[model samples]
Target: MTITALRTPRRLVRVRKAVTRRFARALTGDAGMSTVEYAVGTIAAAAFGAVLYTVVSGDSIPDALGGIIERALNTRV
Candidate 1:
């Protein structure tokens, strides 16, 4: 209808295209995780696994589980 209204949509389209291009460039610019990041992540995962293993292998958990099982089995009903 009006010249301003027609120009407004064109301006919006240009702005949207520019923003999309910048976003795409940002996403594809990096080649993903670097070697140092991978190494650090692996080390962190190994440490977490070691801690988890230590916790699960400790006596308290197994003893608790065994107690629960024994009680359930010995229930009169």
Candidate 2:
């Protein structure tokens, strides 16, 4: 085999190994926790938003707000 051909494969193998090591480190490192934390925070925020929406969409709040608006609009200008 020519020197050029043999050197090319070694270069490619080294590059491949570097990429594999980086990928393994990234997966086994603390960076992975950020994704889980973000997911949990997103879920919690969604749940809180749902609760607030339920409260605001309830009958008593709308009726009370409607009464206030109705009174204000009906008042003398």
Candidate 3:
């Protein structure tokens, strides 16, 4: 194998070790990280679930929203 190819894996391993150490330290130092992660993940999952529910229900929310906007714009005071 070429020098570049042989050295790539070694370099990647060292970088991975460094990253893992840092992540471990950060997790230990930050007591609220787990809670923050859970909150963010829950919010993301809920958003995804809502979108999936809307799609699976065959509801055209975007179209309905657009129609409402168009109606409001076309209506006179």
Candidate 4:
């Protein structure tokens, strides 16, 4: 159509791009990344502690692993 009509669409596109860039920059910066990493590490540590408790309690561990340890204990070499 006319140049004035085209200007509106171009300005809207520029605004959308600017907002998206700011949102992306906020997520990729160090603060957000570090928080995500800390959350993942905390979850991993909790999972490891739960599994350690299960193994130590020995209520229902895997048969093959139990057999291996028993064999190792009984043998010299």
Each model's TM-score?
A: 0.66, 0.49, 0.38, 0.38
State the lDDT of candidate 3 residue by residue for 6-69, as single tens digits: 9999999999999999999988896555877999999999999998997866658777888999
User: Which residue segments of model 3 deviate by more than 4 Å?
Assistant: 30-77
Structure candidate 4, residue pairs in collision: none
Could you give candidate 4's per-residue lDDT for residues 1-77 as a string of tens digits? Answer: 89999999999999999999999998988754477788999999999999899897774667767888999999986
Task: Estimate the overall C-alpha local distance difference test score of candidate 1.
Answer: 0.96
Q: Which regions in candidate 4 have their CA more than 4 angstroms from the true location?
A: 32-77
Clashes in model 3: which pairs? none
Candidate 1 per-residue lDDT, tens place, 1-77, comes to 89999999999999999999999999889787899999999999999999999989999989999999999999997
TM-score-based ranking: 1, 2, 3, 4
Segments in model 1 whose C-alpha atoms lie over 4 Å from true places? 1-18
Q: RMSD of model 1, in Å?
A: 3.1
Candidate order by lDDT, decreasing, is 1, 2, 3, 4
